[model samples]
Target: MTYVAVALLLGLVILVHELGHFLAAKAVGLPVVRFSLGLGPVLWSRTWGGTRCCLSAVPFGGYVLLALAGEKDYLAAPLWRRIAFSLAGPVANLLFALCCYAAVYAVSPGEHSLAGYCVKPLAWTLGTAQAMLAAIPRLFGHAQELSSLVGIVAEGGRFVGASASRLLMLGGYISVSLAVFNLLPLPPLDGGKIVCDILVRCRAGLARYYVPVSACGWLALIALMLYATIQDVCRYLA
Candidate 1:
């Protein structure tokens, strides 16, 4: 049951991230092709307004596809608008973390001094995010202090068994971690998109290279996930 709760919590966190992109696109009048929850074969779908919203069979991750002609076509929008759209996803994750932390604090003020748990978490989260970003390069050189989805569920279930407050705190940490991960300047990630927009705004010749680089980045990300998953499986089996 605790693992089930963690799975549900993860779904909500993902929804929060995707909602940021969906709302931002609507606000800026960008054409959103599909807003999908999960990946693989479509489990269910419905068309609404200009977007086809659906749930896929696998619940690994969600994505928002744009109806633009190509990657660079997004540049047709104002730079600020593009940046906002790109940054919205990660920002939403950050906000979700804050809300989770705030909710937990509100429920049990006795667990922590008021000052220790409230706004300080927001500041601490930002600092933690920066530290995580600085550690990304270590993924190749050493075993990273990162968790795969399997690991998250395992740890989250243990926390849930301990106490509801612990589970909530874990959720908050996961939210912050997701936000920071999305901000990495790699392609197919929110941070990479943000950087691409910035380069375009700066009229840097390298702006054109963003898409190609991101393609490679996606492969690297997949490899990283696979490595992390193997580590998680080995630990679990042991």
Candidate 2:
């Protein structure tokens, strides 16, 4: 049950982001050849007005493939329109996070609003969400807990309950975080695109290497961090 909730939450936010892209592309006369939810092969799809929108097999994330969005077609379009399309995805994510925060806040105890770091998720969220779901098994007379305490992480603790003001604050913080994460100046990612754009206009020699170098560098750092974490885990377990 806990896993299901987590997946659904992630899927919904991602889908809304894709929808934002789709809508913006259509509005700007940029054909969206394929708008897909999830990562792999199609589970289900429907074509409308020269667009093929699909739900894919992967549950991780979704994409809106704006037709020729990276090519001359997009470049030929009005600059404002192109910028709007680029911004739509993250805007949708913020809105989705807000809606989720509002619903959760309304159902809980104190004051709540969509102004803060709701989606950032601290370490306690998993366990809290898990424990809450485990209690539901009682309706079926099951004695075992459905989800167990995982670990403590930032943005997950003390997030549950009745405060609307705090909930909204969390939501806003997470939305800003998502925006900033995408804005990061790096390749195969949104931030990378911006850097590439700059390199193109400035005739920089590093244009081709911008994405690859940053990506590889980050990957190496992340791998080292993971290795260190595994060593720590093994030590603790031993």
Candidate 3:
């Protein structure tokens, strides 16, 4: 039951992040091709408001595809719209974290005031974001401390088993982590996408290389995930 709950919670976070991008694209008048909750082969799909919503076989990650097919197509959109589409996913995760933190405060046994409910959660969310930013540099120094989704789910299961409050806290932490991770200035990440878009817009000559750069980014990201998973498995075994 604990593992099941953790899985569901993780899925919800991914869903929320993708939903943010989908909504932002729609708001900016960009045609969305698909909104998928997972990756790889589609298990089930249905068209809604001209967008194909899909559930894929893999449960670890998700994406929102715009109607654009190539670099020219993507660049045709307004720069601000592209930036908004990129930013929305991380912003959604942050807001979800805030809600989770608020829930944690609400459920705790205490003489909570209106200000307490409002201020404490905001403070905690900001604090968590700050801590994550601070820890980013340390992660490079302490690569072994890095964790994959496997480790995250395992740790989350433990928290869920401890108590409801701890579960909420865990959820909030994971949401913030998701937001921060996506904001890293590496290729294929939201931050990376934004940076590339801005650079290309400023220097149209760079447009030709976008696809190759993005492909390389995806390769690097996959390699990192595999390495992290191996570390998680070895840790569990030890």
Candidate 4:
């Protein structure tokens, strides 16, 4: 039961991430090609409101595919709108994290729960995020220390086994991590897209190199993921 709860919790996080993109695209009048719950083979699919939503075979991550209205139509939209679309995912994650923290801090079955809510959770999340950023130097300085999907599930399972409150707290921390990770200034990421868009606007020459840069970034990320996964498996075995 705890394991199932953890799996559902992780899926919810991915759903929330994609929801941000979907909502932002709709708000900006951008057409969506598809919204998938996972990556790989489509297990189940349906079309709604002109968008094809699918459940894919892989259960790790998900994405929202936006349709180009036209070569000129999409380009005609203001740059700010495009940036907002890219930023919505991370912003949503941050907001969800704040909500999770607030929920965890409030005592349930009591009258003062909502009234006693404060910004402490938000501040704590910020501090935790900063500490994570600071620890990046150590990843290169020492052995691989980051958790992969398996490790994440394992940690979530442990938390769920401990208590629901702990699971909520873990969910909040994971939300913060997701927001921070997506904001990294590497191609294909939200931060990367925003940075590249700005660069292209400032200097048209950079536009031609966007694909190549994004491809390289994708390869780098995949390699990092592979390394992390291997480390995670080894740690689990040990």
Candidate 5:
């Protein structure tokens, strides 16, 4: 039950993140091709309102695919629109975390006042976000501290147990983490893509390198995931 809860919690967070991208793309008049709720082979899919919605075999994370062909290519969009689309996912995760924290506070209001009811959640969410932002500089120096999907699920399940409140708290933390991580200025990440877009806009000559840079970024991300997974395995074994 704990494992199932953890998986569902992770899936919900990923879905919220992707939903933000999907909505932002639509808002910017960009057509969406697919919105998937997992990473691998599709278990089920349905097309609705011109977008293919999918549920895949894996439950780790998901993605939103935008239709970037013909006149509606992502590159052809205005810089602000592109940036907004890129930022929407992280913003959605943050909002989701805020809501989770709010729910937590609503359930267990330490203070009985109306001010406490409203301010506590906001304060908690902001504090967590601030701490996460501050920790970004130390991430590279502490590779072993990084947790892979497996490690996250395992540890989160243990921490959450069967308590709904604990589950909410854990989900909120993961959501905040997702928001922060996506904002890192590395290629293929949302922040990295935004940076690249800005650079290309400033110097159109650099447009040629975007694909290769994105490929390299993906490679690096995969390598990091593998390293984290190995670290998790070693830690568990010890």
Candidate 6:
């Protein structure tokens, strides 16, 4: 039951992201006709102040539809407001992460010592020398262990220093990760849009070359992922 509650609470963080979009769009006098939590078909809905807010059938993602936001006229509004609307979702995620961290630190408070290996700042270092003294080989480069699942197994059962703090750190890691991923200067993504904006304002000719280069870079990344996945599967089967 508590696990379910944790999931539901996490859902609120995502909802807050959509709310940020709704609020920013409304602030700029944009027509926000549909606000939906999750994707696909609507589960339930309400119309308020000319906005049709609904809960959708899918649960993993959500959106606030600033009416005509994707169309040409959406650009009729002020440029600053448009940028603010584009930025709101990720800003909301950072705020939600702070709240999550607060909840975690409230439970199982720990010290910055070796005993913290069972407590926390599990590998805290007072200075450079201490950090060097405590350095240990990691499976994934300074990564820390976090949650425990009831029916899951880990490589070599190596959860020697797992704790709530580590788990919360992982949550923050994922949130920041998304922000970083979204900010990458690639096309078909927020970062790409920003890059396009800059390139248009700066060099008109080089922007022509950016698109093909972006496509090739994406293809390379996909190939790398496929190679890594195949290696992982082979290793697991072995």
Best by lDDT: 3
For residues 84-119, what per-residue lDDT tens digits would candidate 4 score against the true structure?
Answer: 888999889888888887787774455554444666
lDDT of 2 by residue, 109-141 (tens): 675554433542332243334443454448346
Best by TM-score: 3
Given candidate 2, what's the lDDT at residue 15?
71
Off by over 4 Å in 2: 108-177, 198-238
Q: Give the local distance difference test score of model 2.
A: 0.57
Q: TM-score, each model?
A: 0.88, 0.59, 0.97, 0.91, 0.94, 0.57
Rank order (by lDDT, best first): 3, 5, 4, 1, 2, 6
lDDT of each candidate versus the true structure: 0.82, 0.57, 0.91, 0.82, 0.88, 0.55
Clashing pairs in 3: none
| Native-to-model Cα distance after best TM-score fit, residue 207 in candidate 1, in Å | 4.9
> Candidate 3: TM-score?
0.97
lDDT of 4: 0.82
In candidate 3 the C-alpha lDDT for residue 210 amounts to: 85
Per-candidate alpha-carbon RMSD to the true structure: 2.6, 11.4, 1.1, 2.4, 1.8, 8.5
lDDT of 6 by residue, 68-92 (tens): 8343354445556766776677676
lDDT, candidate 5, 115-142, per-residue tens: 7756877787788889999988888898
RMSD of 3: 1.1
